[model samples]
Target: MSIAVQDLEAQVLGLPPEDRARLLERLIASFEPRSKAQEAWMQLALRRQEDVRSGKAAMVPGR
Candidate 1:
């Protein structure tokens, strides 16, 4: 690999978690921003987690 690319990668790695996540989200969203859909799914997932935790829902072993 090129030294310039390697140095850039090192700089990126040095970024804080929040900064890195923001940069990554922008890069991916360049293709298409599904932020709303992502938020909706996250909310639904959290609700499902709460349901499982409260025994409002049950899981069974599967093969």
Candidate 2:
């Protein structure tokens, strides 16, 4: 099941308020969990944040 995100976004934006709310509810429920690679990437992101907070890593400008 594939969708063009931009087209869907445009259609959703054009909907009436009540219909938009209903459609958004269905769309939210249809989303699945992150893949293994995504999970690994998220873990790395969290660890990097922890390292920065503990002064073990330096922040880069414009990040």
Best by TM-score: 2
Please provide, for model 2 over 1-63, each residue's C-alpha lDDT reduced to its tens digit, 9 standing for 90 to 100. Answer: 888999889988999999999997787757956689978988999999999999999998994
TM-scores vs. true structure, each candidate? 0.44, 0.48
Q: Number of clashing pairs, model 2?
A: 0
State, as a TM-score between 0 and 1, how close model 2 is to the true structure: 0.48
lDDT of each: 0.90, 0.89
Error of 1 at 9 (Å): 11
For model 1, the superposed segments whose C-alpha errors exceed 4 Å read 1-34
Error of 1 at 24 (Å): 11
Candidate 1 residue pairs in clash (backbone atoms < 3 Å):
none
